[model samples]
Target: MTRQQAIVADLLHACAHPAVAGAALFALSADAIERARVGAARRRQSIGAFVAHSVADFARVASERDKALLARRMRGAPAPIVAGLEAILENPPRA
Candidate 1:
C-alpha cells in the first residue's frame, strides 16, 4: 500500500465504532467511494488521490477565509478560538 493509503487506512482502523469507521471511510473516499458503491471500481480514483484533492480543497478554503483583512480587526472581546484562528492565519501551516 502507498503511504497515503496506509495513513488513511490507519485512521479508519483506529475508529472504535463500526459506524464511525464506515462514516470516516465514506467521508475520506467521498466521490470515489460513491463510484464503488454503484459497482464501478473502474470509475473510482485511488484513495490517495481523493485524499490529496480533499486536502488541497480544504487548504484553499482556509486560505480564502484567512484572506479577509477585516477579520484581524474585529471589535470587542475576541473568542479564544477566533484568536487561535487569527494566529494560524498570521502564520500558515508548514508544508
Candidate 2:
C-alpha cells in the first residue's frame, strides 16, 4: 500500500484487521473536496466522492448509467494507491 493508503487503512483499522475492514480510503485534493461539499450544499445534495463522483458524473454524461452507478459506489472507498486519488480529484468534481 502507498503511504496515503496505509494511513487511511490504519485509520479505518484495515491494517490492524483485514477481515473487518477490507476497504482503503484514498486522499482527495482539498480543492476537489471543497468543491464537492460546496456544490452539494448548493444543489441540496450530499457530496459522495468528488473524484470518483466526477468520474461517474462524466459516465452519466456519456450515458453509461451502469458505469456511473458503479463509479459512484466506488468513490473514495477503494483504489490501488490512495494517493493516486489526488490525481483523480485534483481537477475536482461539482455536485
Candidate 3:
C-alpha cells in the first residue's frame, strides 16, 4: 500500500470502531462516506479502493466529504477499493 494508504489504515484500525471512525480516518463526514460508498458500489467495487484511486489521482472533488472519502479509500486499497467511482465527477488531478 502507498504511504498515505498505510497511514489511513493505521488510523482506521486504531479506531474504537473503525466503521464509525469515518471522519478521523478519512477526514470526511459520515454522509460523504455514504455517498462515496454508493458511488463505488454502483460500479461494483470496494468503497476503500475507489477512495484510494481518487485521492491518489487528486481529481477535482466536489465536497469536503469527497476529500474524506478519498482518504478512507486510500486505506486498504487494491484489497477492496470502492467501485463505480467516476473520474469525471470532478476535475482531473493536477499536474
Candidate 4:
C-alpha cells in the first residue's frame, strides 16, 4: 500500500482496538480549546461532546472524499474490482 493508505490503515487498526475504541485523548492549542469551549456553550453541549461530534463530522466528510478519490482511480480497473469498490462506496461502515 501507499504511504497514505498505510497510515490510514494503521489509524483504523488503532481505533478498532478495545482499549481505544470509542475514546481518544489529544492536546489542542489554547486558542482551539477556547473556541471549542465557546461553541459548546452556545450549543448547550459539554466541551467533550462538542469535540466528539465535530470530530465525527470531520471523519465522515473525509471518508466521503476518500471514496470519491477511489472511484476516480478505479475508472479503468477490471469490472469486478470496480463493482467491489462501488459497493464499498455505497455502503461505508458506520463510525
Candidate 5:
C-alpha cells in the first residue's frame, strides 16, 4: 500500500486497541510546530492534547462530509435502497 494508506491502516489498528499506550512521532515544519504550540497555549492544553483534539475534530467533520456526499449520490437510487441507506446512516452499526 501507499505510505498514506499504510499510515491510516496503522492508525486504525492502533485505535482498535485502546488499552495500548504509546506515543506517535510526527515530522512538522518549524512554523507548524510553533503554531500548534500557540494554539495549545491559548486553550490551556498540552501540545499532545491539542493535537489529539484537532485530529478528532477533523475526523468528525470529514465523516460528516463523506456521509453528506454519499447521501447526495444516493438520491438517484431506488427509493427503498435510499431509505435503507438513510436508516443505516442515521444509526450506524457498532464496530
Candidate 6:
C-alpha cells in the first residue's frame, strides 16, 4: 500500500484506543490522505501526526452545531461533509 493509505489504515487501527473505541471508522480516499501528507510535510510533521490531527478535526467539525454552516455545506457537498453536517444537526455540542 502507498504511504498515504498506510496513514489512513494506521488511524483506523488506532480507533481501538480505549477512550475512543466506540468511534465509527470513517472512510477517506488515498488522495485525501496524500493531500494531508503534503500538508504535514510542509509543516515538518510526520504522516502519523497529520492523520491523527485530521481525525480530531473531523470530530470537532462534526460536533459543532453551526446551522448556517451546515445548511451551506448541504448543497452539493460530498458524503463526508454531509455526514458531518448531519451529525451536527442530530447532536449539538454541549456548552
- Most accurate candidate by lDDT: 4
Model 5, 1-95: lDDT tens digits are 74433443343344223122113313333554565577669989765565455444433454645445434544445542223223332333333
Count: clashes, candidate 5: 0
Cα lDDT tens digits, model 3, 56-92, are 4443333546545656554455533221122212333
User: Looking at model 3, which ten-residue stretch has the lowest summed lDDT?
Assistant: 80-89
Query: Which model scores highest in TM-score?
Result: 5
- In candidate 1 the C-alpha lDDT for residue 62 amounts to 48
Worst 10 residues of 4 by lDDT: 80-89
User: Which sections of candidate 1 miss by over 4 Å?
Assistant: 1-43, 63-95
Residue range with the least summed lDDT across 10 consecutive positions in model 6: 16-25
lDDT for each residue of candidate 6 in 1-95, tens digit (9 for 90 to 100)? 74433433343345324233222223434455455457568868655555445445544553323433443444444553424323332343334
Q: Which regions of candidate 2 fall more than 4 Å away from where they truly are?
A: 1-26, 49-54, 63-95
Tell me the tens digit of each residue's lDDT in model 4 across 1-95: 65445434444344334234223323343555565567669889766565555444434555746645544544445542323223332444456
TM-score of each: 0.23, 0.35, 0.34, 0.43, 0.44, 0.35
lDDT of 5 at 11: 38
lDDT of 2 by residue, 1-95 (tens): 55543543333232223222113222544664565567557766545433335444432343344334334434565553343333333433233
Q: Distance (Å) between predicted and true CA of 53, model 2?
A: 5.5
Q: Per-residue lDDT of 1-95 in model 1, one digit per residue for the tens?
A: 74433433333233323344234444332443453243223436443343333333324444534433223322232332233223332343334
Rank all candidate structures by their lDDT, best first, as comma-separated numbers.
Answer: 4, 3, 6, 5, 2, 1
Q: Residue 92 lDDT in model 2?
A: 34
Alpha-carbon deviation at 61 in model 5, angstroms: 1.0
List lDDT for all candidates, in order: 0.35, 0.40, 0.45, 0.46, 0.42, 0.43
